[model samples]
Target: MGPLQIKELLQQTPDGQSVTLKGWVRTKRESKNAIFIALNDGSTIHNIQAVAAPGQFSAELLLTVTTGSCLKITGQLVESQGSGQAVEVKIDDIFVYGTADVDSYPLQPKRHSLEFLREIAHLRPRTNTFSAILRIRHALAFAVHKYYNDRGFFYLHTPIITASDAEGAGEMFRVTTLDLDKLPRTDEGAINFKEDFFGREANLTVSGQLEGELGAMALSKIYTFGPTFRAENSNTTRHLAEFWMIEPEMAFFELEDNMDLAEDFIKTVITYALENCKDDLAFLENRLADEDKNKPQNERSIPLLEKLNFVVENAFERLTYTEAIDILLKSKPHKEKKFQYPVGWGIDLSSEHERYLVEKHFKKPVILTNYPREIKSFYMKLDDDGKTVRAMDVLFPGIGEIIGGSQREDNYEKLLERVHEVGIDPETIWWYLETRKFGTAPHSGFGLGFERLVLFVTGMGNIRDVIPFPRYPKSAEF
Candidate 1:
C-alpha cells in the first residue's frame, strides 16, 4: 500500500503501528544521542516529529536530509514526549529521494516577506503562509460548487474567446494568430481581422455573465466560475490582469431575489472555510496578528477569525444607493473634506467610499442598490424614475466591492435602445439580445471575484498573493 498522509497519520492513536511517510523535510536537528526531524507532506500546517537515535540511520543518508529535501521514512507511530504535537514517529528506516542543498535552497527556516515570496511564487506554496492560503482556497472553491449544486444551479462553461465585451469596458486581451511583422490589411488601410484565426476581432472574455444569462434563461438557474482577463495596466494591491469570477444568473428573479442569494451564498462559503479550515485559519490569524502588532491600535485590523465570524453571524445591511450617498455625504471624512474623490449623487463610488460604508459606518457587509444609470452598465433594468438602474454591489470590510450584479433589462426595446446608446453594435451580441426578444423574463445575477474572496478569507493584503500565479501587465512568469 502507499504511504499514509501526514494528516491522517496524525489522527491515529499511538498504538505502535508501522507506517511509511513521504514528504519534504521542514527541519532537522541532531543531538549527541538523538536526531529529530520535523517533516510535512503539505497535507496539514502541522508537521510530524520523527525521532531517531544517533547512528540509527547511515550518516551519509542523514546528511542528505535538509529543509526542502524529499524523503521516504518508515517508522512506528508512538506517543510523543515533546510538546506541540500529540504523536511522534520513531524512525526504523530512511530513504532519501531528493536533496536540496542547505546553502542554496531559498526556503530555509526563516520568515519571508510576502513581497519576496511573490518573486518566487513557484515555491511559495511550500511555505506555511501560502500553504494555509491554498488549502483555504480549495475549501472555498469546493463550498461554492456544493452550495450551487445543492440549490439546483446548473454549472455553465462559457466561452473564453468571444467578439463581445460583456462589461462594455473595452479593455480586453486580443486573441489572434496573425503574424505581427507582416500584417494583413483591408482596402480601408485597417488591420484585417478577417484574416485572423477567428475571422473577427475576438478577445479573451472579460466576463462570463452575458453567456451565463443565456443558460439561466433555459436552465432556470446557472452559475459560472472561470478565468477572466482585463488589459488594464493596474499595479495595486487589489487589481490583477487576470482573475477568476463566480457569476450566477437566475430567471424569474428580481433585484431583491438577487440580493438574498448573494448574501446567503457568501455567508455559506465563509462558514465552510471557518469550519473546514480551522488550523489554516488559526495559523493565518496568528500571522496577521503578529503583522498588526506594529500598527497603531486604531489602524490595526480585528482578529481574522473574529472578522470572519462577524460576517457569517450578522446579516448584511441593505440600503439604496441614494441613501448610501446621503450617509457618505454626511460622514465625518466627507464633511471634513478628507475624501480624495468628491461625493455626489451621480458619481461612481470609489473603493474608499465603499469601504467607509462597510467598514466604518455600517460595520458589517452592506448591499448598496439602485445605482445611477449613467454609472452602471446599460444591461441593468432601468427604474421607473429613469435615473437609476436595479444594480447592487455587496461591499465587505477591508475589501470594498466583493460582488457586483443587477437585474437584467428584460424589455427588448429598452435593451436595444440601451445597447445603441452605449455605442455597441447590436449584431455583435445579437445572440444575447435575442433572449430578451423571444422569451424574456425578469432575471438577475452577480459576480464574485474568486481571488477577492480568497484575499478576504485568507486575510492577505495583496490580491496577487492569493492567486496561484498572477497574470498582470508586466509579468507572467511561473
Candidate 2:
C-alpha cells in the first residue's frame, strides 16, 4: 500500500505492522537511548510519535529532524509506551525531504500569538489552533452541502462579476480594465466605460441572492455557495473585504418557511461539527478556556461546547421588530444611555441592540422579524400597514446577525415602486424585475456568512481567524 496518513495510522491497531508515513516533524527530543519525534501530517491535530533508535540512523540524519522538517519514514507501528498517544512508529528507514533553518523558522515550538501567526499565514496552518479551525471549517462546509442536497435543493453557480447592484449599498468592487492616466472620454468629458472590458459598468458581485432567486423560480429551490466582495472601508474584526456567502432561495415559501429552514440548517451544521470534529473541537475548546484565564470573570464567554450545545438544543426565540423595539426601550442599557447608537422604531438595530436581544434579554438565539420598510431592502414583502417588511434577522449571542432574509414581494407593481423608492434604475435590473412580471410566487431566502458561522461554531473571536487567508480593509497578506 501507499504511505498511510497519520490520522489513519493513529486509528488502526498497532500490531507491529510496517507502514510508511510522510509528514512534517513537529518537535524532536533525544533521550539517552533513542531519538523521539512528534510528527504531524495535517490530517489531525494530534501527532504520532516516531522513535529512531541509536543505530537506526546516522548522527547526521538525527541532527536534521527539527521543528518544521519534512520527512518520509518507513517504520513499524507498535503500541506506544507514551502517556498521551496510543501508537508509536519504530523507524526502519528515513528520508529527509526538507530541513527547516532553526534560526529563521517563524513557527517555533513555543506558543505564538494569533497576530504574529497572521503575518506568517503561509505557515500558520501547521499550528494546532489553525489546523483544528480549518478542519472544523471543512466539516461545516461538507455538512452545508449534505443538508441542502438531502433536501433536494439544486446548487446554482452565479456569476462572480455582475452589472446589477443587488444590495443597493453601492459598496461593490468594480471589475474593469481601463487606463486611468489616459482614459476614453465621452462628448460630455466623462470617462466612457464603453471602451472598458465588459463594455459597461461591471462589479464583483456583492451577493448571489438575486441570481439564486431566478434559479429558484424555475427549480423550486436553489442555493449558491461562493465568494462575494465588498468595498467597505471598515477595519473591524467583524468585517472582511472578501468572504463566502451561502444563500438558499425557495419559491412558494413564505417568511415563516424561511425562518424554519434557517434555524434547522444552522443546527444541522453545528451538530455535524460536534459529531465529526470532536477532537478538533475539544482542542479548540481547551484553547479558548486557556485564553479566557486572563480575562475578567464577567467578560469571559460561556464554555465553548456548552454554548454550541445550548444553541442546538434550544429553540430560537421569535419576536417582531416592534416588540424588540419595545423591549429595548424599557431596557436598562437604553434608559442608562449605554448604547452608543440610539434605538427607536425606525432606526436600524445596531450590534449592541442585537447582542442585548440574544445575550442579555433572551439569553438565546433570536429571530427578529417585521423590520420597518425604511430600514430594509426594497425587495422584501411589505406588510399591510406599509410601514414594515417581512424581513427577518437571525441573531446569535456574540455574532449579531448571522442570517438575514425575507419573503420577497411577489406583486410587480409593489416591487417596482420599491425599486424606484430605493433609487435603483429600473433599466439596470430589468432582468430581475422581469421575474416578477411573469410567474412570480411568494418566495424567500437567507444569506449565511460562512466565516461568521465558522467563527460562532469554533468560538473564535475575530472573523479573520476563522478564514484561511483573510482579505480585510488594507491587508490581503496570505
Candidate 3:
C-alpha cells in the first residue's frame, strides 16, 4: 500500500494475499458471475489481475467502467487463471476515483496503430508500448548522468538561444518576436533581423559542442545534456524537430580517445538499463514482437537481460570513413549500388550509404572517422592531408548516425579564417575565439542522438515512439 511498484508485487511474496493497488484499467472483461480487470500503474509493464465475484460486485457495473478510468482496488492476489492472463487478484473493494467516457476516450479494447497514437500524444503514455518506452527513457537518462558524473565530467548547460550555428546545417528555428510585416531593411535589398529578433539574428541551438568546448578547456572534461532544435523538413523515422543530445568535450584527447569514450559510454548505459528496468525490457521482447507473440511465457522473443547480452557480448566495429565508403560502393545491395549521388573521396556520405556500411557491410554498430573537409563543419580540425577533417560519426546498423563529433580546430588564426571562409561574422564568435587566444588544447568530443540510440536498443521502428511527445511537422497535439 505504501507506493508499491507492480514488479515488486509480481516478483514478491504477496500471491494469494490481500493487497492494495491503484492504476488505470488497461482492460476489463465480464461474464455472468464475475468481472476481470487488467490493471497497470506505470510502475511496471505487466498488468496485475483483479477478479470481482457475483455477490459483492456486479458484472454489468464492472463492464460500465471505461478502459482509461482511474480506480483503486483492495483485493487478494492469486496465481493466474488457467488461460489468457498472468497473476490475478480477488476483489474486496473497488473505488472509482475518476470516470472516463469509454466512447470518447481514444483507446479501446482493440489495438490502435502507431500513426493513430501519434495524433494524441498526451494519452499515448498510458498504453503498454509507450509506458514501457518512457520508463526505459527514465532509466536511460539516469544512466547518462551516472556515466558522465562517475567519470568526473561536469554537467554543463549551454544557452538555448545562440548566434553560432554549431552544426553549420543552416536549418535553425528562428527565435524572433519581430513583425515581418514592417521589417527593417539595410542599405541593400537584404532585410536585417538584427533590429528585429532579440536585437540580433538569434535562433535555437542545434548542438552544444561550442559552449561544451569552453567548459572542457576549464574543467578538463565536460558534457552537455539538453534539448536541441532544428528546422529541417526531413520526414523520416529518424528526424525530429526537437530532440535531446549528449555532447562530451575533453582536453588532451584525440580521435581515438573520443571513440574509446563513446564505446564505453554506450556499454555503460546498456548495463545500467538491464540492471534497473529488467521487466520492461522483458515485456517488449516477449509480448511486443509478432514472431514471438504466440510463444509461451518462457519462449517469448523479448527478454530483459538479452539486450545487455547483445551489446556486451558483441564488439562494435570500427572503420575509417574511407573504408566505409569503399564498403558502401562495393555493397551488392540494389539501393547501395544505385545511390543518387555517386560516392567519391570528397563527397559526404548519404544516410543510405551509412546504413549500408553498418547494417550490410559490417553487420553491427560501426564507427566511421576522417571525413572530407568540404563536407563537414568548419570548426573541425583539418587532418594532415589538408583535404579531410578530423571528424567521426558513429553509425548503428538500424539508425544511420547516432552521433557526430570531432577534435576542434584550436588554432586561433585558423579558426578565425575558418569563420570568415564559412561566411559567418567574426564579431559574434569573438568570445568563442578567446579560448584559443588564452589556452588551447587538442580536445575531442561528439554529440549522440539520444532517441536514435533508444530506438536501436528497443528495436522500435520509429523515432516518434521513443520520445514521449514527438514534435514533428504539422503535428503538435498534446
Candidate 4:
C-alpha cells in the first residue's frame, strides 16, 4: 500500500503493516466473491498484484472497472500464493478516483499491435511496454545529468527555433508565419523570404551542437539535451521527424579527448540503464528471444545480453576512414547487397556501409574517424592531410551512427574558407566567426540521437517504439 518501488515491495520489511499505494490498473480479474488486480505506478518494472477479498471488495464492482483506470489501495502487504509471483497485496480498501469507460477505452485487455497503439499514443503509456520504457528513460536521463554535472559541466538550454543552418544538410523544417496573401516576391516570379519571422528564413534546430559550441566558448564546458527537428522525408524504422539529441561541447579539447568523453558518457548511460532497469530489460529480452524461433538465421537467436555485456566490459573498436575503406574493398566482391555509392577513398560511407562495418566486421560498436573533408560539414577541422576532416561516428551493430561529431575548425581564416567552400553566406555567421576572432581555442562535440541509442539498448526493433508519441512523416497524432 506504500508508494514504494515494485521491486522493493517483493522484500517488504513491514509484512503485516498497513500501507497506501496509488497506481493504474494493469489487469483485473474476478471470482464470484473477490477481485484481483495488477497495479503499476512506474516506480519499477514489476507490477504489484492486489487481492480484494469478499465483503471488502465486490467482484461485480471490479468488473465495472475497465483498463487504464486510476486507483488507490489501502491494504496489508503479503506474499502471493499465486503461481506467477512470490508476492501479493491484501487490499483493505479501494478508492477508484477516475475509472475508464469500457466502451470508449482505447487499450483493450487483448494484445494490440504497435501500429494500432501508436494511433492512440496518448493512452499507450498505460501499456506494459511503454510504462517500463519511460521508467528506464527517467533513470537514464538522471544518469546523464549525473555524468555531466559531476564533471563540472553546465547544463545549457539551446534555442529550439533558429535562423542558422547548423548542419548545412538542407534538412531543416522551415519556421514561418508570413502572410500567404500579398506575399513578398523576388525580382523573379518566385516568392521571397524578405518578409518573414526574424526578417529572413528560419527553422527548427536539427542539433544543439552549434549553439552549445557558443555556450562552451563562454562557459568552458556545457551540454544541451533538448528536442531537435528535421524535415527530411525519411520513413525508415531509424528515422524520426522530431527527436531528442544530447550535444556536449568542450573548450580546449582535441578529437581524442572528445572521443574519450563520448565513450565514457555512453558507457555510463548503458551501465546506469542496465543496473537500474533489470526487470524491464529482462522482459524485453525474453519477449525478443521467444519471438519466432523458426525465423531465419540472421533474425533468430540474437544474444542481446552477451553483446551488451561485451560493450560494457570491452573496448569499442576504433578505425580510421582510410582503414574502413580497405575493409570495404576486400568485402565488395563477396557482398550480395550493392552499395548506392561507389566505395572508394574520398566517397562518403553510405548508411549500408556503416551497418556492414559495425555489424559484420567489428561485431561490436565502432568509432570510425577522420572522414573525407568534402563529405562532412563545414565546421569540422580539416586534418593536416588536407583530404580528410577530424570527424567521427559511433556506429552500433543495429543502430548506425548513433553519434556524429568532430573537432571544429578554430582558425578564423580556415573557418571562413570552409564557410565559403560550403557556399553559406558569410554575413549570417558573423557572430560565430567573431568567437574565433577573440581568444580562440580548439573545441569539439558530438550529437547523440537519444532515441536511436535507446532503441539499441532496449532491443526495441523500431525507433518509434523507444520514443513516446513518435513524430515522423504525417504522424503528429496524439
| Per-prediction TM-score | 0.99, 0.98, 0.90, 0.93
Candidate 1 TM-score versus the reference? 0.99
Q: Compare candidates 2 and 4 on lDDT and give the better one.
A: 2
lDDT of 3 at 25: 90
- lDDT of every predicted structure (CA atoms): 0.94, 0.93, 0.81, 0.83
- lDDT, residue 323, candidate 2: 99
Q: Which segments of model 1 are wrong by more than 4 Å?
A: none
Highest-lDDT candidate? 1
Residue 46 local lDDT, model 4: 74
Number of clashes in model 1? 0
Q: State the lDDT of candidate 2 residue by residue for 392-440, as single tens digits.
A: 9999887799999999998999999999999999999899989998998
Return whichever of 1 and 4 wins on TM-score. 1
Clashing residue pairs, backbone N/CA/C < 3 A, model 1: none
C-alpha lDDT of candidate 1 relative to the true structure:
0.94
Q: Per-residue CA lDDT of candidate 4, range 29-95, in tens?
A: 8777767888878777678888877567565667655677888888888767678877788888888
* Count of steric clashes across candidates, in order: 0, 0, 4, 3
RMSD of each predicted structure: 0.9, 1.1, 3.9, 2.4
At residue 181, candidate 2 shows an lDDT of: 90
